[model samples]
Target: MAHAKVKRLPVVDHVGMLQGIVSRADLLKVFLRDDDEIAEEVRREVVAYLFAAPVSAVRVDVRNGVVTLTGHARDTSLVPMAARLVRAVEGVVDVEFELMRSEGPAEPMAAPANGGENLSRA
Candidate 1:
């Protein structure tokens, strides 16, 4: 409705049956949410559920319904998917990413014979 600048929309059921009508006011009422609420939803729903990662893995910061995501993830492919899911959340104004690819696991590097710290770069 807001996208088309229309005031009302026809509500439909699963079978495409007209259930009722939805006005712009109704949509606003449903979509309006606090910034913290939006951030929690994004963290719980998008990052934790969709990505199957702990909430700590992704840093979610929301201001005025705009979300900014940072931190690391093992699967970088899910970054775009996370963004889409965040956008789908109600009351989210926009999504931004500063996420870094996570190093899957730590490995011990071969030490020099001098018994010193490894100074060689990968």
Candidate 2:
């Protein structure tokens, strides 16, 4: 007599706020494992694109399917552009922009008039 082989199935945790029982297959469909990797790639691509753009001082954060952008830029118009770029990413479901205009100039500091004097010296 020959014995049959048993195949193992994927396990998923369905414990959440929602009521009802969920199986491994159902959970897998609802929460795809590849989603995070895809989202991360999208985030990196968006960040690279934004950094390459003329606009400076732009930050990006991606969680789940939402992308949050917070930072200041010289041109106000660039704020919308940043949001649009993130939204265009494949895995991004939505984009939230909290970008604000820079309060003041970002010019480089000028050297002290005194020759190589330490201002912090007591």
Top-lDDT structure, candidate number: 1
Give the per-residue lDDT of model 1 (tens digit) for 69-96.
Answer: 9887777776776777778777887899
Model 2, position 111: C-alpha lDDT score: 37
- Estimate the TM-score of every prediction: 0.63, 0.43
Residues 1-122 of candidate 2: C-alpha lDDT, one tens digit per residue = 01333233343458544455545555345334354664554334544343333223666666676767667744455556556655655555778878676755443323333431322221
Alpha carbon RMSD to native, model 1 = 14.1
Q: What is the C-alpha lDDT of each candidate?
A: 0.71, 0.51
Worst 10 residues of 1 by lDDT: 113-122
